[model samples]
Target: MNTRELTYVKAFNEGMHQIMAEDPDVFLIGEDVAGYGGVFHMFDGLLTTFGDKRVKDTPIAEQAIIGLGVGAAARGLRPVCDLMFMDFIGVAMDQIFNQAAKMKYMFGGAVSVPLTITTAGGAGMSAAAQHSQSLEAWLAHIPGLKVAMPASPYDAKGLIVGAIRDDNPVIVVLNKKMLGVKGPVPEELYSIPLGVANIVCEGDDVTIVAIGRMVIEATKAAQALGEQGISAEVIDPRTVQPLDIDTIVTSAKKTNRVLIVHEAVQFGGIGAEISSQVQESAFDYLDAPVTRLAAPFAPVPYAPILENAYVPDAARIVAAARQLVERS
Candidate 1:
């Protein structure tokens, strides 16, 4: 296997650069994304390389950023708008939901927006309430917007390429915690289709469905469970909106037990949707109830200790999955 290490941030940056060079329609617009290289430095040198036309920077207004992207997209341009934080999606939901999302359908599928809205979300690093949020569930409920949460460097590259090429409005959430993570990634340009689930690790005892940064935590927990004689499967639903129910349900049925994990609050997170879908799709095959591991319903605390507690970690996932295995 061709293997090496690369941070998640680099993979995204490289992939964005590659697509922009190859496709004239592909461009980026966001706050500090061009000249400033973005808050996380994901687009550090892109503006210099692609010039102002492709690497455009805009004001801090979320609505205007998204509104401009919608107009650009409707004109056959593939515009990727960085929302900075997924929490700010609330401010631009109208442009995302009412315009970019519903445009093609409203026009009888004759026009395609071909837009990708990429944002970062998570509860680590003490970004606190205004910044840290796992809001994929909010956008996934909309019919026209595609939601993708890539967990690894490989997925980060492939999914971004896929999102840029997609005809509908897509929301790609890059968890702040996972940006520095390194993993084996391909050098060639490729695409991970929307609505696909990646089974990072597989076992027969229990299936763990994780999103974004939680996938790494779930894998670590699965290893710990292995030491205790529990075989846990780790499945990352790369795209939540176009959820791969078939893949997840099949894995759950084979194992007969399932655990849903995410960085979002327990209430109304994507974990509930996965849990409900598992129960509905594989109800007869389950040996035990599906359990979920998620942040509690509260703002993320700034203190390191409280912040650690606020986000679901490897230990908690191990404990939760082990309890389910014991019951089974």
Candidate 2:
């Protein structure tokens, strides 16, 4: 495979572009997506490449966009709808939670919606609480929705391609902070199947399960911990819904310690689900408590300093892991 460095947005655009060209049924719809190329330039020039019909834009309505995508999906067309910000999904909960997510099951498997919703989630760029919330947990809790939060550019393309190709609805949230981060991405189109986890780093001391933007910080924490001779393994669950619990359990078993990290608030977060799963499956392997590194249970603060404190950083993960190690 020919590989090259690409920003997260570039990788995402390339994946969508490649999939659209290969699949005649695949199309995209979102606000300002056609002419403006999306709010974050993630859809830059896609309108020109795919034209108005396939790269259609809509008014500022989240529910309308989901409705269109759901209809298209039910009619055998693969539609990738962009909500811009995942926080807006709250406004369209009925469309997502009641309709799009449950269509196939409700229809007794009469049809499947190869529907993919791409949005920006998690705080880092000071987008404030409205634009920066990691709601992967909310989506994952849904019976029929597949939730994915990619960490790096390489996985961004592969996981998105996989999500769009799946025979079910998938929610892929792109963290804005990672938009400009560059990493190795293959030139050819491919997919990282849903429910798979990547062993980003291997160690025998601790297993660090990080999602979205927290993966970058967790990686840094692992590197710094290496200096202290603390071996830490990092695992990124490419798709949160289909969890890939086995990989996490194996990693925790190997390390004997588990530390979950995410940009989401601590209470009622995805980490709790992961922590529970690990404890249930790998309780005997843990030499210490299953720790967590997450933001407090509060809205994302707008001030830079407060936001910085509100988000999990490399230092936070490192310190948490260090504490757990000391306790063990």
Candidate 3:
């Protein structure tokens, strides 16, 4: 395991760079991704390294960008398309949900859509409503689509590498708040399977299942709970669609309490599905109802204070966990 300190964005760059270097068919396409190195600098020096043939930039059309990627992927090219912001997925919903996601299934598994969609998600840096949203649940709801929400640098690289090699379409949602976050990641190429869950912290009192940026908040909440003699286990479901429900059920059974956290809204969020699964699988084991900590069902606010309030934080998660643990 050749590991080194790296930020989340840098880890993603390493993953794409390694794959593009090894495979002649692997290339990148999106807006400003080639020359400007992407809005978040995910493709920093990739254009210079790979040149225009592989790292071509497109016009400001999300639909066209994704449509081209789906077409390219169908033609045996492993295209890593960056959509800039997850919010723009709405413009390309037809291409994503209808075409790229359903092609292999519609063709009786004869054709493959090895397309990887990378985009920035979550409410932070005051990106406002249109630019900040965690819409992974929307993609996860569609069949034949794999969704990956990496919380750390290691998972970012590993998941991206894995997504690039998969035979189906994969949406890799990078939490924008985590871009500058640093973690120890392996320098070598590594691919973490899509359905595996990482039990970040082990405890007995409660289970906290967090996705994307919420994982960091959940971890902090776990630490705070520990100080108060309340042990909380933290679980990160690296992939949302092919969810690792077994690990989550086991954790929930052991703790007898579960608290789900995500940057998405509370109503009809991914947490609802996870909560239902846990209730069905470990209902007898749970001492209290499954609680979810998430943003309100409203557009992301522009003000810093409102945006902060809109996003679930460590304190909110801690309070929710405390409630679940203390409920009689």
Candidate 4:
């Protein structure tokens, strides 16, 4: 594979640009996406490369953005709609959950909404409650939508390509905190299959299943646990909706303990679903109850310190894993 180091944001930009060049039907429409290169610089050179026709900018309306994407996708065009922030998904819930998500089912599989909604998520850099939030659970809750939360630049590039190729509506959630994080990504276009979880690290003591930015924390926690002679396996559920429960359950069964971590609020979060599935599949194999390490049920704070406190770090994950593993 031809690979090069790229930041998380750069990898996605490369993937989208590569796809747009390869497929004439794929286009991007969102607020400030063209001339402004997107709010996060996700479309820095896409507009100039694809031109105004394919890289059209839209009004400051999330509802209109998603509606246009749904309509375009239904009519046979692959549209990548950037919502800017995951928190804004609430504004376009009808278009997402009701329209784009239900198009194929509503049409009795006669139509496919091959639409990809890419948005930044997670709390860090003190984006505050309005702009910072990991709402993957909300999208995953809907039956028709596919949710992919990429933790690294390599995965970001591959996942975006897969999302674009998908015939169903896919939500690509990028953790804002990891925007600058760099990793080696293939120079050529490639796709990482959705719903497949990556076992980042193998261990036998405890299993830590993390999503998005939390994947980094989970790995760090695993390293720390290793120093203490506690082998902790880290699994990154790259795609949350079509969750790879088998991989998670298998790891949980081997480790006999599991810790689900995410930047989103613990209550009603995706962790709850993962924890429940693990328990159901590996109930007899588990030595302890599944532990969940997630942000408390509260708005993301604006202050850096508060934001740090709100999101779980490696230390917290390590502590939770130790508690889970040590329980007699």
Candidate 5:
């Protein structure tokens, strides 16, 4: 019942510590994860706590790293493979989509792959295109893969614990910019069920559904809209795969308007899917079209100024919400 403010990185580290201690079959393997404590220090103190047998550092080969996880998980071991950067997932696509994801299904449920893939994503630190990209949509599209994006310290810990315990392969995509953000988190081990939506702020005028770090921006936008007498509800879809469209549709039915936001490019993003479902389910309740505010169709810029402009902010959300609300 007690809680403390912990940064996203710290919460993530604590979750790993608790889960690894509780489950002997769980192990971590990734580049710089053991000795370096992860590039973002999300794995700090884990190596010391669990030792080299559990926390292992691997070569820079993502394919081999994922392959190792697939094999270990199929053999009854729980492996948390750190992909370092989500953008590098392309290098190990075969192991992920072909092997790890399809193994249990192809084997007729004879084998289970409790593989957890943790990676950093989203653009903010100007890591450039290669290092920063919100690719949750790609993983969510896969039939056997589960994708989760934590927007706060509490969800960071809860989702990580949940993902590690899931029997199927789950990808926990952490935003690089939110690693230092702090929020209330329980000291004890906890697991938030995936496929559930969190109603960050309640309202009746408009629904603002945001993913990952954009949830923070959407919350700010909601506050700003409140000042203008335009009540805005904010929802965070904790896990994209097995998404809780019922929560979203219910909110849309109440508000009669919906706006989805994300850091990924607008085209072919998860927002599109959410918008489609909302419109289909709540078409009669709608006063306006379901809108989406997201990054432009371009690579994440390296320059700070350009990157700042590239990523959507609270101002953009506020403006978009205002427009959607005004549309009658």
Candidate 6:
């Protein structure tokens, strides 16, 4: 288990480097991915290592970018397309939903769209409403797409590699704020299977299930709750579509209380689906109702003051956990 500390962006770069070196059929295409090395520099140094053939820069047309990937993937090439910002996914919805997502099913398993779509998401740098929305829920709703949201450098590298190797169309949603966050990741190539949940910490009184950037906030809340004599367990569902509900249900059965948190808006968010499944599977074991903490239904604000209040944080999570535990 050799490892080194790397930032989320660097770990992703290493994963891409390794995957491309190992598979000749794999290549990356997206705006500024080759020369500019991506807006966040996540794909930095890839063009120099793999050369222009494997690393290509495309015009700022998301629809054309995804359409090329979809077509390339259907023809037996593994194409990793970058969308820059998840907010721009709406512009290429047809290529994503109608083409890449349904190609395998439409061809009756004769064709497999081994396409990987990577994009940056989350609201922390005042990027405005259009650029900072957490839209994994929309991709997860599609039947043929697999959605992953990594919280750390380790998961970031492993999940990207896993998504590229997977035969189905997979979307890896990276957090803009977590790009510089550091964590221990294996120096060697590795892959983390989808549909698995990481238990961040072990506790008893309450179970806190978090997604993406909220996982970090949930960890902070668990520590604060610990000092106050409350035991809180934190679970990170690394992938939302193929969610690991069994882990959450098992935790609920132990703690008898559950709290789900995410950066997405509460209404029709993934938290609602997780809540429904947890209650349905572990109804009799619960001592209290399942609760969720998320952003409001309004668009993401631009003002620093409003954005700070908009996204959930450690203090908010701690307060929510305390209230859930105090319920009688």
Task: Name the lDDT value of residue 312 in candidate 1.
Answer: 89
Model 4 stretches astray by more than 4 angstroms: none
So what's the TM-score on candidate 1?
Answer: 0.97
Cα error, residue 183 of model 5, in Å, equals 0.6
Best by lDDT: 5
Q: Which residue segments of model 5 deviate by more than 4 Å?
A: none
The global Cα lDDT (0 to 1) of model 5 is 0.95
Error of 3 at 307 (Å): 0.9
Minimal lDDT window, size 10, model 4: 319-328
**Local distance difference test, candidate 4:** 0.92
**Per-candidate TM vs. native?**
0.97, 0.98, 0.98, 0.98, 0.99, 0.99
- RMSD to the true structure for each prediction, in A, is 1.2, 0.8, 0.9, 0.9, 0.7, 0.7
Show model 3 residue runs off by greater than 4 Å. none
Question: What tens digits encode model 6's per-residue C-alpha lDDT throughout 1-328?
Answer: 8998999999999999999999999999999999999999999999999999999999889999999999999899999999999999999999999999998888888889999999999998999899999998899999899999999999999999999999989999999999999999999999999899999999999999999999999999999999999999999989997989999999999999999999999999999999999989999999889999999999999999999999999999999999989995
Off by over 4 Å in 6: none
Global CA lDDT computed for model 6: 0.94
Which of candidates 1 and 5 reaches a greater lDDT? 5
The deviation in Å at residue 104 for candidate 2 is 1.3
Deviation from truth (RMSD, Å), model 6: 0.7
lDDT of each residue in 159-265, candidate 1, tens digit only: 99999988889998988888899988877777899998999899999999998899999999999999999999999999999999899999998999999999888
Pairs clashing in candidate 4?
A: none
Encode model 3's per-residue lDDT on 281-309: one tens digit a residue: 99999899999988899999999999989
Name model 1 segments beyond 4 Å from true. Answer: 1-3
Candidate 3 vs 5: which has more lDDT: 5
Clashes of 4: 0
Compose the digit string of candidate 5's lDDT tens values, residues 93-204: 9999999999988999998999999999999988999999999899999999999999999999999999999999999999989988999999999999889999999999
lDDT of each: 0.90, 0.91, 0.93, 0.92, 0.95, 0.94
lDDT of 2: 0.91
Give the C-alpha lDDT of model 3.
0.93
